[model samples]
Target: MDKEFTPRIAAILCQWCSYTGADLAGTSRLQYPTSIIAMKVMCSSRVDPVLLLKAYLSGSDGVLLGGCHPGDCHYEVGNYHTRRRFAILKAVFDTLGLESARLKLSWISASEGPKFAQVANDYTEEIKKMGENPSKKKMFL
Candidate 1:
């Protein structure tokens, strides 16, 4: 019997904003897919690009990066750094023949619980349409 396909998502969230937003989503009883696994980071800028690549290569169908809005990062320019890095990461994925759409970045404040839930649901659906990550079948040495 063939097992049903379910997209796996890795969410790297900023502790001050996105992670707190996710917590609010939970406390507010917002419903989202269980396919997402979230990790909290001190800042979005602290998330290495390699970690995002590794998540996809390791079988995550999609990766979600959430951070403070522009000009609102607690660390002053952290989100700016994240924006630049994400742009480069997308370019690298495209050059490698990977679908860059599998990666997403969103600005969510701690007060935006509804937005968090909406993003999660929407991104989950998008990933479902994209199917599984092709790299999952490849052997990387």
Candidate 2:
């Protein structure tokens, strides 16, 4: 474990809120880890469990799913759907011998730039302490 390990995170953000919040974090010059690679989708519910699995299998040490808060989604109940789906995804991860801690679900409003940055930093540190994803090594086999 002496080798340098930088955790790679796949962040899927809702365009209406989470993405905007992340963008605002950047515009505000907030400091967060560079390990996250964010992808914006129309809504949090649009993210499929398969997509999250793919990210993990493809060498991502962690996956962060960000969406609007419940009752505040632009698409009414989209965030609710996301919350349910995320739970199922976590179960699937656990069944597959993957650490469910590697997956994070966060609700961030468009105005919560500081919160987004803090989440990013915290999640990044957690992943660093967790080390690399074991699934990554198995992917090549």
Candidate 3:
């Protein structure tokens, strides 16, 4: 791999939970990869399938969806909805020839700053190993 090759990751973080966790990671000065571009949403369930696909097509090497833990969502059932949606999204990604590893979902609470940093580091490395998004390359050419 080229030394300059850096993966591009699109991260959708639940505003009430994962986003707060990420902010904590930042304030705590935890080191993580800088490859991710994060967007905060009211709930993880709000991350539409099209949005994930579009992110890949637009050159993101991976997509990460972070939300509250299964039973602790601020909106009660929001994380549950996210879980179901991600399962379907995974199947869609498979059907579209996208590797399942390139799309990930995690439950990160507001108190899990270390976990957030670790996730960022780990996902960045995973995306780097996967290289670029082939579909994006083809579409761009």
Go through the candidates in order and give each one's C-alpha lDDT. Answer: 0.92, 0.91, 0.88
Candidate 3 residue pairs in clash (backbone atoms < 3 Å): none
Candidate 1 deviates by what RMSD? 1.7
**Per-residue C-alpha lDDT of model 3 across residues 1-141, encoded as one tens digit per residue:** 656778888999999999999999999999988897889999998888678867767778899999999999998998898888889988987886768788889999999999999999999887787788777758444
Instruction: Decide which is better by TM-score, 1 or 3.
Output: 1
Say which prediction, candidate 1 or candidate 2, comes out ahead on TM-score: 1
TM-score of candidate 1 against the unseen true structure: 0.94
Q: Where does candidate 2 have its weakest 10-residue lDDT segment?
A: 132-141
Which pairs, if any, clash in model 1? Answer: none
Candidate 3 error regions (>4 Å): none
As a whole number from 0 to 100, the lDDT of residue 131 in candidate 1 is 84
State in Å the error of residue 84, model 2.
0.8
lDDT by residue (73-132, candidate 1, tens digit) is 999999999999999999998998879999999999999999999999999888888888
Over the full model, what C-alpha lDDT does candidate 3 score relative to the true structure? 0.88
Model 1 accuracy (lDDT, Cα):
0.92
| Per-prediction backbone clash count | 0, 0, 0
